[model samples]
Target: MARDPFATADLEIVGQVTTASNVTLVCGADGVRVVYKPVRGERPLWDFPDGTLAGREVASYLVSDALGWGLIPETILRDGPVGPGMVQRWIEQVRQPVGRPELVDLCPVGEIPEGFREVLRALDGGGRPVSLIHADDPRLRRMAVLDVLLNNADRKGGHALDGADGRVYGVDHGICLHTEPKLRTVLWGWAGEPVEDELLSDITLFVKALPGELGDRLAELITDTEIDALETRGRALLDNPVLPLPQGTRPIPWPAF
Candidate 1:
């Protein structure tokens, strides 16, 4: 097989991704657009092992590919302009429709239209009931499923985006694949709903492929123990395919947007 362009291309840092911990850029070449996250630039977190976020990001991509969710953009671990890090293909988001006030902000609880699921409710600065809604989009539903499989610890509202092709693309997965159950996300719309047949089928296939190539790929980015935990989660989901109820007192990320 021909080598992947993302791994072989000469990377150049065109700019910095401010919201990200250690993210940067690769001057796009050969139609390859990517965001680079160097290990050296990673901010250390107490809960996670030091200097492993980049690897975790790559592992997230492997899991996404294995599940055939395509929720994550193409990502790989390679030498970048700064050093070795995770390089992910940049997703060009489609312009969000205007005139939809709720599309980007917290709408009043009473104003939310029917069909939208309320994921968050809080008192705004004015002491009014501010509610956050999750759109009933198929792509978003798929992303929610992917997050559960990865045991994603951060799925803020902003992490999910509408790609140019009308598909949902999820990013910022540097803190996933924890050995413990740490699924915190803003996609509580289907909190108690059973997993769809199509999604379950995908998870089934992923479990079947895990003992071989997929497992090998993940081993390169995470510990053997972490991989085992991932498989355990997959099998459990296969047995009871439902969106896991929120764990811990606080299940949603703060500043949800």
Candidate 2:
């Protein structure tokens, strides 16, 4: 196989994502734009081990690729201008029309549109009642399934991008693949709904491939126990084959974005 030019090309930092918790740099490498999350810039979380977030991001991409979902962009763990980090191909988002929702959005309470599922009702900053909802699209449905398989702990609305290429891509997966059940997301719109047959079939094959090349690559990034937990989640999904409801107090990430 030919080497990836994006991996070897020099990355020139163009901007910093100030809103991100960790250091996130937007860089350009040989005309290709990518997001660089250096391991050294990762904030120490009590739950996850230090300097492992970048690897987890890459692992999420690998799993997404193996499932043939293409929900995650091209991602790799490589030495960057700062140090070793996660470098992912940046996706250009498709601009939505005024008052239109992309994947997830907020609307007046009890005014959910057709082909949209309401997740929660809450008071906005103005003390007005509003509902959080997501689209009833197949691409987003696949993303929800991918989150289940990755045991993704953070799937904020902003992470699900409506790409210019007319595909939904999930990003910011540094907090996924933990051994513990830490599934947190705003994709509860499909809770209790049956996963599609085709997706279930794809997941079945993914579970079977877990102990082979995919597993080997993940082993280099996450721990053996995490990989085992990931496989267990996949098998469990195949057994149930349903989108699960939110458990515990905090099901969705705060701020929703």
Best by lDDT: 2
User: Candidate 2: which pairs clash?
Assistant: none
Tens-place lDDT digits, model 1, residues 1-257? 97666778787666776765455555564567788888888878888883389899889988988787888888878887778888888888877557463323567877876556777789988898888787877778888888888899998888887788867788889999988888889888888888899989998999888889999988888888888989899899899998888889879877676
- Writing each residue's lDDT as its tens digit, candidate 2 over 71-114 gives 99999988888999999999999999987877899999989989
Residues forming the 10-long window of minimal summed lDDT in candidate 1: 96-105
TM-score versus the correct structure, for each prediction: 0.92, 0.97
lDDT score of residue 11 within candidate 2: 93
- Against the true structure, candidate 2 reaches a TM-score of 0.97
Q: What residue pairs are clashing in model 1? A: none
